[model samples]
Target: MASPSNYSSAPVSEFLLICFPNYQSWQHWLYLPLSLLFLLAMGANATLLITIRLEASLHEPMYYLLSILSLLDMVLCLTVIPKVLAIFWFDLRAISFFACFLQMYIMDCFLPMESCTFMIMAYDRYVAICHPLRYPSIITNQFVAKTSVFIVIRNAFLPAPIPILSVWLCYCGKNVIENCICANLSVSRLSCDNFTLNRIYQFVAGWTLLGSDFVLIFISYIFILRAVLKFKAERAAVKALSTCGSHFILILFFSTILLVVVLTNVARKKVPMDILILLNVLHHLIPPASNPIVYGVRTKEIKQGIQKLLRRGM
Candidate 1:
């Protein structure tokens, strides 16, 4: 570890976020679309949360979990996108080192928490479908409340070291970050101090959080499939699979885009930096944008609840 004097000696005070360094002319035009997406994400998620909270009919364990998901989606979008839009719209790229790490920590913690939340939801669906009789005991209100706390604490503290350790590193090099968001490696690479620990911890912590979540989610689906197949009739299997369809589709998009971002990041030398960065940014936005539309709007129960709420409004 570097000494305190080593960190204090650095002259840099803030980081300049160079968003879309490649696109010179039309990057400003990106403001409207990105802003629109952010508004839509916030609106959709906020509406879902309100609908879930106010309506007595949605006071079930599943809706509670869906509410948690919506809250996370709204948080993830709010945490990252506003700063990005600032960069695009007003050229307010200068963010304090303190703010940078704060952003890093929030994004790091919440993104993984969302991933874990998806895994938790998968298990919830599995129990609800595969073992309906035991669903009550398996996933009670108490369980969801306790598990929500665990998810936040586990994800927040597990990756806390990544940014905490990062702040200690001496950043005497260029203060310009290549990416829009305060991404871990993007900011870390600017440090003059030894960053091997940061890199190693990132790899280990990332796989531990993301890898384990993906593995368990996959296992949940496997069990779901097995349970559905053992129904002793084709129609039953279809019905079972159909019940999981919305969740499956949502998780599929979430995992696929994330996997693509990871792969492209690993093979980044062969790809355009803009594309890799776009994937990174979109990974934050797309799932949140789709959540309320897919889960709240298309979901029959949520849809009916919304219509009921609307009718009551009229």
Candidate 2:
């Protein structure tokens, strides 16, 4: 433990991100796969954005929501992956204080934004299936525009205090971050001062934002399921299920991985550090990589739009 007297020394201006120190010799092997995922996330989301923009028929609320998701995924990938790759490929692990905090802020903000997006998407499906007539009125392009603004503002401002609180801590002793990213917990733990406030805020804010979104999404899906079950025609039921199946799969993937990471962290002593670190890295990369591909393969409208775009290019 660092002495109380040492806490008064100069605060750290930079942090050394020791990414996967236990597997240092073999960690370089991760570079290729992570890089590929980064490229895939960028390319696939770009394609989705272009397809949605060019296809006049796709200028609707659902596709607009998808475009928002793609935009979020793209920004997330851009923010984290490049620096991660630089660290792996060039052995550049030093992150300046401001940059580290900025990364933490963005990660904290955008993750909840993604959760809120999934909740909005669930509501969109619920309206379409449960109140088909009202959906047209309720889920208009204007409504989606407003929802987009809400998501940005809610997520941006709500989590702003996390990184800000972390910045106020005095990190005078150790500047080495164990994980690849500047996660709030990892960064704040190094502080010389009592970081109980930081930890409490992080826990309360994170669970509150994500937990509320999850509950709403669950309620929306329950209604959707009931409406689908009430369908008289077998074809109508199947069609409704097909429409929601893609979104459900994505929600499952995103939420399940997150749950596992959280549980493992709670039982940290039992779980290997390398495994936890790898899970965190994968949580960031895999969803962005898979989200577009899942929609492209499963959604008929997006598939056709991609085909049309390709044909036009050729």
- Best prediction by TM-score: 2
Candidate 1: list runs displaced more than 4 Å: 1-10
Error of 1 at 184 (Å): 0.6
lDDT of 1 by residue, 1-314 (tens): 22112233457898888777788557778889888888988988888888887788889888888888888888889889999898888878789988999989998898899888889999998998789999999998999998899899999899999998889888875788888899999988888888999999999999999999999999999999889878988898887787778788889999899889889989989999888887888888889999888886557888888877788789
Candidate lDDT scores, in order, read: 0.86, 0.90
**True lDDT of residue 73, candidate 2:** 90
The residue-level lDDT of candidate 2 at 52 comes to: 95
* Candidate 1 to truth, TM: 0.94
| Per-prediction TM-score to the true structure, in the order listed | 0.94, 0.96
lDDT of 2 by residue, 1-314 (tens): 22113223566888887789688878888999999999999999999999999999899999999999999998888888888899889988889999999999999999999999999999999998998889889999899989999999999998999999999998887888888989898899998788898888988998999999999999999999899899999999999999989999999999999899899988889999888888888888899999999999999899999999999999
Task: Point out where model 2 deviates above 4 Å.
Answer: 1-10
Question: What's the residue-level lDDT of 191 in candidate 2?
Answer: 88
